[model samples]
Target chain A: MRTFSKHTPLEYAVLYGRFLSLYMRSKMQYKMDTLLTSAAVLIRECVTVVTLYLMLQKFSVINGWDLGQLLFMYSFVFLSYSLCILVFAGVRDFQGIVHQGEFDSYLTKPLNPLFQVISRRSDLMAMLGHGGLGLILFLYAFREAGVEATGMNVLKVVLVLIGGILIQGALLLVPASLTFWLTKSSQVQEVMFYQMRGFIAYPISIYPKIIQWLLTYLLPFAFVNYYPAHYFVGVGSGGDGLAYLTPVVGLVLFGLALLLWRTGINRYKSTGN
Target chain B: MPSICSSLTKFMGYVLSVNIGNMLFNVWTKVAPVLIVSFLAFHLVLPDQAYMIVLFLISLLLGYFVLYGFNLIVWLSAFWFHQTWSFMTIKNAVILLVSGATIPLWFMPAPLEKVFSYLPFKDVYFTPLSIFLGQVPADDIMLTYLTQIGGIAALHISLGSCGARRRRSLSFKEVSESANVQQTYPA
Candidate 1:
């Protein structure tokens, strides 16, 4: 939770809810700006979707999955990424935070530094646009994939989404946290966030084996969308059981990322006294 | 000549003082995507064609200028509208889609392909990719490059000059403001 201090998880949730309300209050004051920016985000996302539609029109299927299945995978990825962006907007701008000597303020507070970093800002506009569109696409693709709207199926989808957010958050943070040592790591973050994750929106299988191996073993982005979608859509290379391992992998990776973050903080060189 | 030499030295000094490691990382992020895509193209989709490679290389050279000009325009737009981040996202999305980074131009609808052909967006990515995939005929390559050169010239002179003018005005404003403050405060 964003406000996790010495409080219980429930208390953290309540405090985070209050922070959410505060953020919303400030954000809602700029209705037109929010509306326009949200529309911008929506249009940017639609461009990708439209491109995918065009490609599918040319070739009915890519790597074995049809457009419907690809959309389902992409939707999951989009939903998770938007959730991470909303919750961890602070981490995304870690370079700015470090440069502006804002990290010191977090250190002085009696809160988890990571929580403080993450909960400082919430991108409501991105969440509304990216998440709303992603959800719609997910449902449309779900029906196309003939995934029954059963309660268990819904629960699995929810879990996969959570796993996705965790994985994406960890990946975003790992590069960002390097700012502690590197001093300026926005470029590194951009490489991961923009290039690597952008490629993940499509099926990783289409890539050569080396890339597939890199995404699976080194980066571990495959678990974020591909593996889970495999379990749901039944359209991937073997290890159906690995699909269920999404949450476990997410949790483990998040833990490792936290460890890396803590280590980076220890190595942090403050701007000035 | 003396002024140009002094300014060049000053620019070099500034560049040297800036963290080279960070600069390299930034450059790498830009270049690495092209490398990855090239790797994918070579290994997965298309085999190496000798003539196509020559065309691809030339297109890439032209694309460097075209993309750099476009980036400069976008960067300069930030001076006018501080909220150019979203603008950048939209711009990149449109470029990626129209330039055949997302879908090869040959596969696009005929009308759509024709529309994009008239724009410089295809010159950025599609021209090179299409060349590498042997989609472009050798006969048309000369005309394509000529068109690209015209575009490169227009963009470089127009947006490029505009950016230089903006920078000069901004520096003049800063100098005047600082002088005024010094006069008032007597620092």
Candidate 2:
């Protein structure tokens, strides 16, 4: 029954555009609240950067990476995370959808359930907050780290940004898909995704070898920022070679996440109200 | 009256259980392995004085109370603001930075460190960790303990005042409705 979506790609895009506009308008209805919340998010994110700056002021460098290189690497995590949430807020909140019996409504629709989920809501405040900071950091650190951007390098950065977004989205999707069996996966997602992502904000090499291995093999959050930063900044010790594999890792992980999502959907039993 | 006391007891019991569970998890996952390895490698040096351990434990207990009071205030703010996620997130971020959970306070600029020293956030993490590491000088130990106790008392007093204000502003109809719901639920 869930073999194919009847809607074409163009139709899906149009529907998604409508969803985006609707979400934006609804959010805009309360301008003050939106502004305050966005500002709060911005300040919350800046706290980590401030902490990093303070630490760097004392030590000058950590794991042989200076403040500029560190920020350059860290900016990718925020940029990709903001964009990922923009597109995949629905997936992130899938537990709520399932728990509220909204998944039943999606199943009834002619559109793909995943598409419906993907286009349901966009966190514009978070996007603005994180994206604004990320852009500032990237611009400042790009020059500070002395990464001369030719057209080719700019294109590569864009590709890496897309890959990073996919990897982060997949990270959210995998835990969300577990809500089908677990009924509640937010805590798992919290520890697995958010808590683990904190490790990558600094160089993972600074951490214990066990934690480094956990981030590398068990979670692969390193591929999100650390390895890609290596590609651009060329400073980290090992995994310089793995820098080229960012997009590949992202694509593979995303594909696996989709497979998990499909399996979850197939097994889904709506909570009958 | 008995029911109210029992409910309070239950609430405290739940909080204590959760805190113990978290403590055990942290000790097992984070502390135990390193301690065992250090002992096996003969690289671990026990503190010369037993009072240091006692002081550290006292600091830890005070730290917990300080944090609980701080979080209670934040949780109570929900009565005024219907949505508290932003407040909680901002609070967590502030605590993470000021408490030296992310970076040690000594790493901070002198002026900024002075400012944070005035805040209660440092008592939650920085004080306990510093005490454990034996970084708090013997002369300052009593002073640190006084500050931690003072912070807890200040927080509790503020919480009490907030509760009193909430009670005064609460309408009879709202109270009756809540009481009725509670009676019906019989929790």
Candidate 3:
């Protein structure tokens, strides 16, 4: 078994591909279950978007955000989240791995534990469901919001989206890493990550000053969508230079998360199951 | 009968656990802090009318029963379907959309609003919220209560009949299986 440290980035990428394909093949064995679960997820996500659309029909706009811009903003959350879960499903479900003593196997292997955890699983259903909705919303809203399909703009959008995905991964990783000390960190992830993300589905400016501050400085989910949407939609205020800082924030937070994960791995003791 | 009682106890325990979780996680972490901050820093004022508060609580309690009935019906459908998660998901999505939890009923399109008015989903969330917001008129409060009560009664009646039918079918299957076993064994 080759140690993970000796493997080049290209080799890691190839291994990741292999692991992903293996999981995908396993998932494909239950085609009906996969389809149904994906459909359920799609419908679940559609409810909020549909509700917003319906509400917009009556109200026209919410806190200076029109339907198109709002959808564009919302697309960021779903699209990035789908990609994030695809890459980080194992981390997000780290509690289950620990509970089942599967983490012990990862530790025993010559491979990096975090890499093993990440490459262990992917939520293809969530990726399909959320990614499909997000693509539809992005395509529709790109035209409706009048965002030009210039090369630079496209590059910027792609970069910002990558940053958003990283931010979401870090959010999941931090709470999951807490499983080293806490028996149940899923609730912490639920409130800190999921619930907090819900607040940023719309403009953070609409929230109270305190919440805005919290999103800006403390949790920093604002960099995920609100900031980038301001740059793309060109309507919201307070994101002048902050819009470009998403990648920086994402990188910094993800780095810190890795540090925390490293510390947690060192502290980890087996569940003795 | 004893089995039914045991299952009922288990169901109640499940409901109790859910409530406890909501109180501990949701109310304690999310709702309480916001409410406290609003009350202290922002000087938020709740409705002063005691009777209105009582009515709101009553409606909320009724709404809980209405939700419980709906969930029980879905849970009982496990007898028919190998997987009921899809049903639960669809049900939850429908409830989230139509119950005025996501968007107020007034904000919904006219036809959708009209359709939702007839749905038990509205009574679960919208009615209680409307009553709390003082949108429901004094004379109409009783009517709203009646509609909620009516929804609960209708759901329970259907569930009771469904459970009876399920029990009968299960017993029939068991008896036939036992009969086959006796024939094969020459008992």
Candidate 4:
């Protein structure tokens, strides 16, 4: 097997693709299962969007943001979240690895531990479910909001989305890596990935000042969708410059998470030993 | 390929195969967390009307059974389709929407509200919530109770019959796969 550490960026990408495809082929052995799972994803996403639409119909707006703008924000949040799940789902199951002492196996290999853990599993059904649907909704909402479809603006949206995914992936990794010390960090993972993550589905402004502050500074989830979305819609108090910080914040958070992960690695005590 | 009805049937079949204690334990395992959280949260808020609180408790009790009955069916679908994770996600999303966990039914658009009224999902969360918020008037209380019962009855009977059919038709491979149930409710 080729060693992972010396690979260039292009080579790394090819290796990751190979790992993902191998997993995909294994999953696709159950064709009906894959199709049903994809359908379930599609249905779930549609229902969530519909719930938002119905709520929008009642009040016509939430916290001064219109439906079209809300949809744009919503779609972006979904897109980034789904991408995180697609790319870094193995982190979601990191607890199992630690419990089973599989972490040692990754370390034994010549590959980068993080890459091996990340590319170990890929839920492509979720990618097709949320990514495809989210893109369509984002475009439709973009048109409804009357935003000009210039190339630069589109690039900005795409980049911000990538940033958002990174932020979410960091959130997953940070709590998950804690399993090295905590042994069972599923509760922490649930709070970060599920409960806290839900707050991003709506405008952060509707929440009280304390929650807004927590999301902004403590958790930094505001940079995920709220700040960038506010920038796109040209609403909210701070200057448009804050919007540019999203991708930067994403990169910083991910770097911090990696640092935490390294610290956890140093502290790791294999379950068997 | 697993229609809701067929899945429900299969789940009911599994339910019949399991012992009564085990079945209740299974439901409790799924429900205890929510109950504990709600119990703690209930102390945080003091309702103005005692009668409304009483009505809320009653409606909530009924809602628990109704919700769990539906949830049980959904959980049992895993026996047939190991890919029920996505299906469970979809079911919860739909329940959140139609059951008024996301937004109260009153705040919902008229057409959506009308549609939800016909579906049994409202009894799962919405009806009880409306009672707690004191949104449900006294006259409408009976109607809601009747609806909740109707929903529960429909699910209970369907599960029973479907489970009976599934227990008879299950192959040896399926029996081995569902070892958890077989250990409890022996053939």
Score each candidate by Cα lDDT. 0.75, 0.81, 0.82, 0.77
* Model 4, span B137-182: residue lDDT tens: 7899999999999999998787667656655444433332443432
Instruction: Evaluate candidate 1 by giving its C-alpha RMSD to the native, one decimal.
Output: 7.7
Which runs of model 4 end up more than 4 angstroms from their true locations?
A1-4, A8-11, B1-47, B169-187
Per-residue error at B136 for model 4, in Å? Answer: 3.4
Q: Report clash pairs, candidate 4.
A: B12-B163, B13-B163
Isolated chain A: TM-score per model? 0.92, 0.95, 0.96, 0.92
* Tens-digit lDDT track of model 2 for B1-187: 4544455435434544655676688899978998899899767866678889899989988998898777666655655653445555677778999999999899988998999999999999999989888899999999999999999999989988876677534333332222222111000
Ranking by DockQ: 4, 2, 3, 1
Score candidate 1 by DockQ: 0.26
Stretches of model 3 off by over 4 angstroms after superposition = A1-4, A8-11, A25-32, B1-38, B41-45, B80-85, B168-187
Model number 3 iRMSD: 8.6
Clashing pairs in 3: none
DockQ (CA atoms), all models: 0.26, 0.32, 0.31, 0.39
Q: Please write out the lDDT profile of model 3 over residues B18-90, one tens digit for every residue.
A: 5556556867777889989999989976666878888998999899888877776665665665345655676
Better of 3 and 4 by DockQ: 4
Cα-based lDDT at residue B56, candidate 3: 93
Question: Judged by TM-score relative to the true structure, which candidate is superior, 3 or 4?
Answer: 3
Encode model 1's per-residue lDDT on B1-187: one tens digit a residue: 4554455435323422343444467569767887788787766465366767777889887876686567556545645544344555567778888888878887899999899889888888888777787777879889888877887888878875776666533332222222222111000
A best-first ranking of the candidates according to their TM-score comes to: 3, 4, 2, 1
TM-score per model over all chains: 0.76, 0.83, 0.86, 0.84
> Which tens-of-lDDT digit does each residue in A1-273 have in candidate 2?
545556778988999999789878987786655666677678889999998899899899998999999999999988988898889888887877888898899889777888889997777787888998999999999888878879988887887888888888898899989988898887778778888888988999899899999887767888878988887888878866887777887898899999999898778887884
